[model samples]
Target: MTKPLKASGFLGLATMMVVGLYQFTLLAGGNAVPGWMIGGHAHLGVISILAIVMGFAVPVIGVTGRLRTAVTGMFIAGQWGIPGVVWIGEGAELPFLMPTAFLWGICLIVSMLIMLYATLTQDSSGIGGEATGVTPADD
Candidate 1:
């Protein structure tokens, strides 16, 4: 699970770098890329970072087994799906896909929420016997 998420993140970053250079070239040529394309690129970058962060967070938070799989899958799907729909919709001039992209966004949000809830609900020892909360230094 962690491997796939991290891989996706790295892949997304690579893709972003390529698209960003393309966008730069377009701007340099005095060709205006659509606002929606720019928006999709930004989303791709952010979601990619989120995926990488979540990959590291998963093990530390002790979201193991099937639950971890589900959460990881959600993040991965959002990482790919959101901007994909946007790029496809705008590039193809099919505007309807814009609204549908929100569904993928929800997956990303809910996955984070699950991580938060798991962290907060754990006992003082936390999951896998690791501390989930901060401990102040003795004065």
Candidate 2:
């Protein structure tokens, strides 16, 4: 995969791992012995999963053009908005997992932006010159 796609995938995986582990920790009773233990970890997990799937789809499938643009935009919006909503609804007292969630959100947004730029401007090599053989000229 291209650098942007790789970055996006890594960010997505990181988000999923962090949020999933944090939620599992909470579900396994880790929030009880903490001072900044909000239950937003579960929401983070959901967001992370979405990010992971979207990131994977952006690079894996032949979804260039406006479809790719739309997906990347949605991914960015979700990554940032979900955490913002969680933070707002859960108050400012973030737990141990909050930082990871925030980082993941930023990474997702940045990665999606990169992917969007590449998709919009780069040639039809389909990320890293993978050769989809369906260039704009062919269409």
Candidate 3:
């Protein structure tokens, strides 16, 4: 994988971690978190899993156009959707959580855009290179 794609994948995983932690905190604190928050967390979790799966599946298939685009789109949508649901829909009042959520959203958005570019421009040739059955590069 190219540097940007690797970075994007890491950022995507980070966003997933943030979403999961946020949900777990909410649930564990017994604050009656909104159903939308739970749903949003679930959505982000699914996106994260998809990213991981595609990261492996793409190079395995040796075809890397449509699936990449779809994953990028889903990542962008989930990143924005989570914040929209939390801040706008639920109106969460925790000031400290806001910054983390905002940063996570921004990272996810930028990373998704970069990944989308890599996907469209054929720059991430080895994105799924370690999915087994493929020769590993010496470098």
What do the candidate models score in CA lDDT, each in turn? 0.87, 0.56, 0.57
On TM-score, who's better, 1 or 3? 1
- Model 3 Cα shift for residue 85 (angstroms): 5.7
Across 1-106, the per-residue lDDT of candidate 1 in tens digits comes to 7999999999999998899999999999999988877988999998899888888888878887777988988989889989999899888898888897888989
Give the C-alpha lDDT of model 1: 0.87
Greater lDDT among 1 and 3 belongs to: 1
Mind giving the per-residue lDDT tens digits that candidate 3 earns over 20-90? Answer: 78777878998666766666566566555555654554454443467455545555555555555565545
Runs in model 1 deviating more than 4 A are 126-139
User: What is the Cα-based TM-score of model 3?
Assistant: 0.44
- As a TM-score, model 2 comes out at 0.41
Q: State the lDDT at 102 in candidate 3.
A: 59
Which residue pairs come into collision in candidate 1? none
What is the clash tally of candidate 2? 0
Question: What's the TM-score of every candidate structure?
Answer: 0.85, 0.41, 0.44
Ranked by lDDT, top first: 1, 3, 2
| Model 2 local distance difference test score | 0.56
Q: Largest lDDT belongs to which candidate?
A: 1
Query: Which residue window of length 10 is worst by lDDT in model 1?
Result: 123-132
